[model samples]
Target: MSKEYNVAILGATGAVGTRMIQQLEQSTIPVKSLKLLASSRSAGKQLQFKGQPITVEEATPDSFAGIDLVLSSAGGSVSKKLLPEAVKRGAVCVDNTSAFRMEPDVPLVVPEVNEAALKNHHGIVANPNCSTIQMVVALEPIRKAFGLKQVIVSTYQAASGAGQSALNELKQEAQDYLDGKDIQDDAEILPTKGDKKHYPLAFNLLPQIDVFEDNGYTHEEWKMIHETKKIMLGDMNAKYIKVTATCVRVPVPIAHGETVYFTVDDPSVTVDQLREALKGAPGVVLQDNPAHQVYPQPLNAVGKRDTFVGRLRADEENPGSFNMWVVADNLLKGAAWNTVENAECLVKDNLI
Candidate 1:
């Protein structure tokens, strides 16, 4: 851990990929060489790293030669194809895709929630879903202090979570609607770009995030349900940890917010006690103040790297039931920052 390591980012030109570079630059992790890899079309593009120019390379199986760490934000197909190639070359991969998330072998980690799981990585670690990442970071402390029993969450995700093109579509559609012009629905991207149908995300909420599953829940919802149980159980049969989720896409450009309801094992835990626990939790920013209407907002949390939680209150009918809201820069804490943090955990613990 003395000498800096050579790190490669697999999808360097995309939204979360670019933020990974930014997070690396801001991180205390000493990096010797930075390799930026994208699709063939994005190769040769120039990017900045601590003021020096770094050129993007096409992501191929041979891209991992001499690489020590591969922080990837590429899609599942790319990860499925290339991650093992990187690992074969002796590089540890922190993948930000759904490809290996639920694999019994690959550890799905949020550094704030389950850094201990890093010990089980077999050269690959999966980052949790963006919506799941923020929600769990905000709730992990509560779960530890109050004892989580049953939980429910609904997400208001931002367009930036969809990628750069989705942001453009949102802006253009909003402008078209505002000008009273004939709005043409472009079916290229959105809701799930790879899915069958695309809809206008401007001035609307798309109930679906990823492709729908046979059981009626979209993949996004399933990710939240499964990932939460995995992280909380730590190898136990988490079947009793009742969890349900509803994911919606909003017009926001950055930050994902969730309103979560949960029943704790401790009925004596007051809102004041929960507030105190969240106030001092790592990777969480507590912003609760009902009188001032202070709570987590997408606009205020766009570029920040911390999960903000607020709106703590008791559920009116159910004793021991409580509700809270959470927010975080979806691309940062939800993706890039968490990826980098996992890599840092490996290095800090000498696991790699």
Candidate 2:
């Protein structure tokens, strides 16, 4: 008989954490037991899994006792503090946070893009940023078929990427607006929670995602630029790939969509070849049909695990450059599903 692992979920009540729970219930991993860990305030709450109610507990250093695997979606600081402790207690952690993503030792992974990288993990495997995860999935096959040289992406991100509270604010603000109530720019938590201003997302678009860095690129944009190279190429080879991104938060509530313009090393690569490459790509659903006016859209992508690709065409101005549209549920393949997929890879390889 195979071993049934004991598993734990950190940040159990957060938006992504809760979706992690849902994915776990349907996952093929033999979960002998499940532990839900969160801050003290969220402790004692009950979350349903596999038709049973599990109590949420306060996450302490000892929370990993006898746990074989951990799926963590906690904030970066919490992950930085607790993941090492979990590893020390003999648990393998798949962290869905930005804390260790750029670390030299950590593997920033999208399982479809770089499952083999998991072997290099000492104790922790980091999930790529939500936006980065979906884009890389769509691009990896193309990269394999035709060597990629440059990539430029602009994202139409959903409110849920900011967390459940941001989604709630969008709803409340939209309702207040529809009622002819004063639409206060009542900004508080978004673009970045710690940033100085908050703006209503109901009927507006924010040109920024995370707070801007000194270089003028927002942190979220930087993640797409950096994480793409990290996942596609190793740490050293990342510089060989030229990448730039503009990430924006739109009013959509579930899925994220992107327009990616990429240059392939093969000058002769045709639009048909690009479509064929993506058509057969794992984790990708090709939806390109121009004559009938078909394409991938956020409303069509919500709740789906596969990244949808459409509007594929060669750039007329730049030889070897092609543009395509990609969309996926930010909370699924973007976060929880990718985390679960990494855990599954670890189990199948017997690395944990």
* lDDT of the structure predicted as candidate 1: 0.90
Tens-place lDDT per residue, model 2, 37-135, is: 999999999999999999999999999989999999989999999999999999999999998998888998898899999999989999999999999
Clash pairs, model 2 backbone:
187-198, 188-198
For model 1, the stretches where C-alpha displacement exceeds 4 angstroms are 235-237
Q: In terms of lDDT, which candidate is strongest? A: 2
lDDT score, candidate 2: 0.91
Off by over 4 Å in 2: none
lDDT of 1 at 185: 66
lDDT tens readout by residue for model 1, 1-352? 3968899999999999999999999987789999999999999999999999999999998989999999999899999999999999999999999999888988999888899999999999999889989988988998889888898999999998999899988999889899986555653699888887788888888998999999999989988999998877764247767899999999898899899999998887889888888887989999998899899899999889899999999997887899999999999998999999998888888876
Q: Which residue pairs of candidate 1 clash?
A: none
TM-score of 1: 0.98
